[model samples]
Target: MELHEYVRLDGVGLAELIRTRQVTPPEVESVAREALKIADERLNGLTRPSFPNALDAAGDGPFAGVPFLLKDVPIAAGVPFTLGSRAIPDIAAAHDTELMTRFRRAGLVALGITTMCELGLSFATESARYGPTRNPYDPARGVGGSSGGAAALVAAGAVPLAHANDGAGSIRVPASCCGLVGLKPGRGRIPCGPDTGEAAFGLLYEFAVTRSVRDAAHLLDAVHGPAAGDKYLVAPPLRPYAEELDAPHPRLRIALTTDAWSGVPVDPEVAAATARTGRLLERLGHTVEVATPALDWEDVLAGIRGEVVAGVAPLLSAPRQPPPEALEAVSRAAMSEVRAFTALDLLRTFDAHNRVSRAVGTFFADYDLLVTPTLGQLPAPHGTLDYDNPRYSVDSWLRRLFAYGPFTAVFNISGQPAVSLPLGRSASGLPIGVQVVAGSGREDQLIRIAAALEPDFATAADRQGTLDQ
Candidate 1:
C-alpha cells in the first residue's frame, strides 16, 4: 500500500481492505509508519521512542492491523505513560488498563504515544516537557489539548483514529481545532479502569478521534462496555454504535446556543458557523431553537476545579514528589493551593456538581440535543495557553481553559455524551467544530446525528493537503 492510499482510508476502510485480502496487515503498517514519521517531523506530535514491536502487539479483531496511536495518558503495558509532564517520570505501565486491553482486542495497532498538556490541565497542547503539538491545518496554530497530539496525527493522516480521552473538553476541543470527529461518550458509557473506579471524579471519558463518523461509531462499538468492579455503568447501546449510522431518528428538538457559560463572547466566525449548523439541522427536519441550559457558572467552575485538584493533588504529594522545576507553573501553584483546601471545600464542590447536573438534566427533558460552537475562538497560536508562564495561579489557569472552551465542560460536569463534528470551516479554510450533545446514555442519538452531519464536512484526503506544506 502507498502512503497516499493509506492516508486516504479511514480505520474501517483499511480494515475492509485487509479483511478482503487486498492488502496485508504488514503492508498497511509499513505505509502508516512512513506517514507517521512525516507527521512527527512536520507537527512534533509524538513523544519520545515509538512503540517497539507494535505490529506484533496487535490482536485479531474487527480492525485487526489498522494503524493506531495511544495518547500518553492511557496505560498500556510496557508503553510509556508520561501524563505529558516531566513531573511524572516516563515509566512504562506495569499492565494494561481496561481500555488499553480493549484497544488490543479490537486489533488496533498503536505505533506510539502522542503528546499532551501537563497533567492534562490546559486547552492547548504546548507542554514545556514535549513542546507544542502543532495543528496540521496551520502549523503556527495550536492543536487543542491534552488530546492535541492524537488529533494532530489523525488529522495528518498518520492514523485513521487514535485513542483520546476527555476531561473538560480535551477530546472535542482538539477535534474542533484539527477538523476531525471527536466523541466524548457520556460518563459511564465507557469504563475507566480496574485500576481506578472513576477518573477525575467521573469528569473524564475514554474514546477516540477519527476522520469519519463511521470510524468513530465502529471504534466505539469495539471498546465500550462495563468492566468488573467499575463505579458506574450505563445500560449498553441497543445495537452496535456502527448500526446507529444508518438508523433513523425522529425530528429532534435541538437547542442551539453560541453563548459561553464563562461570560466570554465567542469569536464571530465560530458563532456564525454554529448558527449555520443549527440552520442545517432545521433543514434536516429538526426543530432548532435559541436556548441554553440555565447554569450557575461559579459553581460549575468551582466543581471542575475541585475535580482537577482531587486528581492531581495526590500526584503532587506522592512519596517521590516531582521537583519544583519538573512541574509547570499552574501545577506547582495547584500544589501550593491544595494544602489550604478544607474538607468542606471538596464537599461543597460535590454539592455544586449535584446542583449543576440536575439543572442541565432538566433542560434535556425538553430537548433531544444541544448545539454550540466547540470553542469560543479559532485554533489559538502556540503559547496562548502557556504552561511555563509563572504568572498563572491555579484559579486563573482554570478560568482561562474554560473561557476558551466554555460550551464543552458543562456536559462533562453534567456527565452527558457530546461530540464535536468538523461541520464548518472558517473563511481561511480552517475547520470549525459544532458540538452536538445528548442526554446521559444517549450516544446512540449522537452517532445517528453525527453520521447525518458527516457528509457535509471535507474528508481526510481534502484536509490532508496540509502535509504538502
Candidate 2:
C-alpha cells in the first residue's frame, strides 16, 4: 500500500487490513517509520534513535501489528525512559508496568518514544533536555505538553494513534492543538501500576490521542480493565468501549459554559468555537444549556499545584540527586515552594478534592455532560510555556499555564471522564478542541457522544501530508 493509504487508516482499520493479509505488519511498519521520519524533519515532533525492531518486540493479540508510541514518561519499562528530564538521562526502565503488560496483551507495537515537557511540569512540550515538539498545523506553534510529541506525530500522519496520559489537561491540550481525539479517562479507569497506584493523587489518566473516536474507543476496549491488587480500579464496562460508540445516546443533556474555571475571560475565538459546538449538539437532539455550577477555582488550582509539585519533588531528589541548576529553573522554584509542605498539606489537598468532586457530582445529576473549550485559547506559540525562560518565575509561569488550559484541570480535579474533540478552528485555520466532560467513571457517555459528534469536524489524515510543506 502507498504511505498515504496506510497512514490514513485508524488503528482498528490497520489491524483489520493486517489480519486479512491485505497488508503485512512489516509493510505497515515501513510506511509508519517513513511518516515518523517526515514528522521529525518537519515538525520536530518525535525523539531520535527510533526503535526499528518495534514490530518484532511487540507481543501478539487482537490488534496485533498495529504501530504505536509511548510518551517519554515512566509509562512502560525496558526502553530508554527519560521522564522527559535532564536529571535522569539515558536510563533504561527495569520492568514493564501494568500499562505496558496490558499494551502487549492487546497487541500494540511499541515503536520507540516521543518528546514531552520535563517531568510533565508544563503544558508546553518545550523540554530543556530534548527541545520543543512543534504543532503539525504550523511548525511555529507548540503542540501543547507532556503529550505534545504524541499529538504532533499522530497529527502529522506518522501514526494513526499514540499513547498519551493526562495530568491537568496534558492529553486534551495537545489534542486540541493538533486536531485529534484526546480522552482523559476517569481516575481508575485504566491501570496505574504494581509499584504505585492512584498516581498524581488520582487526578491522572492513561489513554491515547487518536485520529478517530473509534480508534480511541477500540484501544480502550483492549486496555481498560484493572489489574490484580491495583490500589485503584473501576468496574469493567459491561460491554466493549467500541460497542459503546454505536449505542445510542441522542438525548444527552449537555451544559455549556465559556467559563475557564480560573475565571479569566476565554479568548473570543475559543469561546465562539465552543458555542458553535453547543449549537451542533442541540441540533443533534441533545438539549444544550449555558450554565456554570458554583465551585471554588482557588481549590481547583490548589489541588493541581499540590499534586504536581509533591509528585515532582521526589523524582528530582532521588538516588543521590542532580545539582539544582541541572533542573529547569521553574522546577527548582517549585521544589523550593513544596519543601515547606507538611503531611497535613497533602491531606488537606485530598480533602479539597473530595469536596469539589461531590460538588460536581451533584451538578452532573442534572446534566449528562458539561461542555467547555478544551483550552481557554488556541494553541500557543513555540516556547510560550518554556520553563527555562528567565522572564518567568515559578508563580508567573503557573499563572500563564492555567490561563492556557483552565478548562481541563477541573475534570482532572473532579476525577471525571473527559474528551477533547477537534471540532473547531480559528479564523487563521489552527485547530481548536471542544471538551465534553462526564461524571466520574462515565467514559461510556464520553465515547458515545464523541463518536456521534466527531464526523463533522475531524480532519482526514490524508490532508496531514500538507504539514510537511
| TM-score against native, each model | 0.98, 0.96
Q: Tell me the tens digit of each residue's lDDT in model 2 across 1-469.
A: 7876876788889999889999998898888888788778877766665785783344457678888888887656667777677877777767887888888878888887998887787888888788887777777888888799999988877888888999889899999999989999988888888767677877877888999999888888888878888776677778888898789765888899988767787889999989998998888899999987678877776688777765776765678665668778777777667777778888888888877787888899899999999988888998666687656655577778898888888778888899999888788888989999987678988998888887777557324434333
* Model 1 pairs in collision: none
What is the lDDT for 374 in model 1?
93
lDDT of 1 at 152: 96
For model 1, how does the per-residue alpha-carbon lDDT over 92-143 read when each residue is reduced to its tens digit? 7888889888888899988888999988888899888889888888889999
Q: Best-fitting candidate, measured by lDDT?
A: 1
Each candidate's lDDT (Cα)? Answer: 0.87, 0.81
Q: State the TM-score for model 2.
A: 0.96
**Where does candidate 2 have its weakest 10-residue lDDT segment?**
460-469
User: TM-score: which candidate is best?
Assistant: 1
